[model samples]
Target: MDKDLERFVEYCKIDTQSNDTSDATPSEAKELNLTKLLYKQLKEMGLEAEIDQYGRLYSKLPGEKGLDVIGLNSHVDTALEVSGKNVKPQLISSYEGGVIKLNDEYSMSPSDFPRLKNYIGSDLIVTSGDTLLGGDDKAGVSIIMEVISYYVSHPEEKHHPIAILFTPDEEIGRGPEHFDAKKFGADYAYTVDGADVDMIEDENFNAAHADIVIEGVSIHPGEAKGKMINALRLCNEFDASLDPDAKPEYTSGREGFNHLMAMNGTAEKASMHYIIRNHDMDLLQKQKDEFVSIKHRLEAKYPKAKINLDIVDDYKNMHEVFLKDPRAVEHADEVFASLGITARHEPIRGGTDGATFSFNGCPTPNLGTGSYNHHGRFEYLSVKDYRKMIEIVKAIVKA
Candidate 1:
């Protein structure tokens, strides 16, 4: 196995799934283990490293004066949909454009995903069709590690000062809650969390969450007709109110999505969790307004139903800052084109640690990790693409 992919698989085995329910800054206890492990590795590489009380880990490599410090940030948290613990990564020697069987029950086939053709001659690492491979950001972390190791081994290479930061609870959208941007001390940064080899994202969705609560009167089943109202029925109606075409599965590219995550109800009460997302800020506000109008209409129909709707704004597009300063995006594109990789500019349908960092202070952009079908059994990364990413980093630092 190549050194970077080897290190990535090792890190994946050490689960770091974050908990959103915890009040702690990291939001999970397991996150500390990865932080501590990274601290040791950084110290071994002869860099000053520290893990703050909140489980944020930072490391520094000093360089010549007058050279600006560049930061590389990656979150150590994994998505909560699958088991991150005891992840067994399967390595395919070389892609031959066929299905890869994971167990008796599941397989990843080229017929289902045509992108597999892009990896016809590359090495691939995947999961066992039972658990996730955790490549979402661990691949990012591994890339950072390899770059640091390269610089440490090649002292003659001309480079500026570098900062390494590992954040926690990124999967749960709280990675930047306690991030000290000033303390990070970098003029700009990049989050290696994208899923393609040539993707450089400066735009992300304007996000907001909504929680709908409905109350209904319960009566004996024999006399339930007209005397009792079912909250579950109301909840179903609420779910159907959103445009069917605006769902994750239906939308693609720059199109928006309105996700009705979950609903639980009985005759007495019902509640739903919904998240609204769109790239344009104006459209995002309009989506929220539509939701509010729907709730009001439902309330008017059932006077005593007592429906409550709560909407909370989450994050905004980083393109505002990117437009203000186009140097970073332009420079990255120039370097990527020079390296023979086509730079693809696209809006992120989801959020990233870079979005929060960009809004807070730094104009951070999300770079590619070369992984596909993240947070599932079919997750995989191209070894060739991963190595090309390291070259992209070198080009950025050298420029």
Candidate 2:
């Protein structure tokens, strides 16, 4: 087995699904499992690696003087939207291009996800039907690990100072909450957290998380004529008021969305969690305002009920910061071109830790690791693109 693929498979088996409700940096203790593994591996390879109190792992590879310090980053935690536990990776030596039956309950089909056709002859790493493969960022982590392993074996090929950061809770938008830019000491960085092998992402959604709580008066059905204010019904009403056409399933390609991530409550109290996203800040704010407006409308309609809406700013589009200093993207494009790959610049509909890193003083752009259908059971990685990502990392550092 390829060492990188082996690392990815090993990491995927450990459950590292982040908890959005947790205030801790890692959000879950299980993330430390992977953190410890990465830290131990880096140290064994003679690199200066350590895990912070917050479960953020930093590994440094020393290089010649006068070269700009570069950082390679990837998240350790998988998305909380799906089960990342007990992941059994199924390896396809060579894809023949058709529906891949993960199990009787689920399958990955080219007709459903057209991009599967892109990797016809390449090897694939997929998950069993019951869980996600964690390739969303595990693939990225393996690529970084491969680069470090290569440098460890070939010390004479060293070029620039390199820093490796494996973060926790990226799936929950807390990946960079405790990231110490000064400690990492990298002039620029690239997060290997994107989807396509040929694409480089510079822009991401301006994000905000909204929590709506509806408190209503609950009474016996016999005595609840005009006095009953059912919070559950009100919650349904609130969700119905939002634009249905602007949801994740309906929107794409620069279109913003108000995604209702979760909802749980009863007649007395109910809560709806939403993630609002847009490329433009002004438009994002407008979307937020719409959420607030809906809350106010609900509150007005149900005078006896209390409706509270809280919107928290998550991360902005990293492209705003990158546009000011585009040397990172330029260097990445040069490296991609050198490897016979065209740099396809695209906007990310979702957020990444790079957005937080870029805003936090390290200009970082997102690079792809041949991952597709992230955060779901259908997720898979292309072995060919995965290996190429390792080479891309080496090229970026050696350049």
Candidate 3:
């Protein structure tokens, strides 16, 4: 465990933040650095490991009796907010019940996030307030590495065949794009990528991407009084047509949103991208139908103006899949209880790699590692909670 934490800090020091605009598979070459390191370490532990063409790492620990294979997965890429480079982790010996200073201006405060009271006697690992701790999934990766290595080194532990997969570009929602489910050869999997320690999410949002492209005819500026149909203006009209009350910033919990991701165009043409999300299948269909109606309305207003809408379903809620197999929930609950954690089954407001993996036939769910306020400067993790999660995984495997 000590070696794992040391290696995790080293891994976080390398900037592996994925770029949303990049066309490459890994999105950034720096991501491969961790994959290479993990591959070497897995091989050193005398296990089979390799980095695939798409820069994902897959390793296996063969088990006796050929029982249903269990898989543990985590992503290596961090969010693109700040440079993940030169990460310096600070370990707090024990919570003193006051604000812990990271720098002159910044400190992790219980006043802002009252959940800090939950870990009053627990240890913590935080950043220098200048960069993210990268504990989102890096901590998960470290736990998986430590647990798997321990089991491999001590064969006396009775556990099912385990598969470990490290994915890239998960921060950008493309982790499953390059994944081959059939090749993974696992009965089921769990993404050790949740925010809080006892969180186990089997339900997530049904996500889709919408692209609206508007084409308008631009005449001479001098005679533009009657002939100019600005595409940029139409984009705003389209945005205002959606439900204003249902947005990420305004809504929380099960509430969904029509997020306006990007917009770009000249007078002749304009394009806007939106991501629509909802948990209810019926509501998701209604949202798309409304978008189609909006497209027709714009076309009617301007006969010469052309508008096209493209919608693609990303992933669906995994509730049905989990319902089909009761063992997954029962096993996780049993393990969390054994570790003295109150397991909470909640719906993920956002999508996860497990959601895609579930749709792709893995029936995967998300498990937590005790991270909070992710993708921001205030992000911090519970050191004790993090270590407890490793024990939880081991218990789950044995169960």
Number of backbone collisions per candidate, in order?
0, 0, 0
Ranking of all predicted structures according to lDDT, beginning with the best and ending with the worst: 2, 1, 3
Error of 1 at 107 (Å): 3.3
Measured by lDDT, the strongest candidate is 2
Clashing pairs in 1: none
Question: TM-score for all predictions?
Answer: 0.90, 0.85, 0.91
Write the residue-wise lDDT of candidate 1 on 147-180 in tens digits: 8888888888878788889998988888887788
What lDDT tens digits, residue by residue, belong to model 3 across residues 88-182?
78877778878989888788788887988888877777888888888877888888988988898888988988888999999998888877786
How accurate locally is residue 148 in candidate 1, as Cα lDDT from 0 to 100?
87
lDDT of each: 0.84, 0.89, 0.84
Provide the lowest-lDDT 10-residue window in model 2. Answer: 348-357
lDDT of 3 at 154: 85
lDDT for residue 361 in candidate 2, whole number 0-100: 88
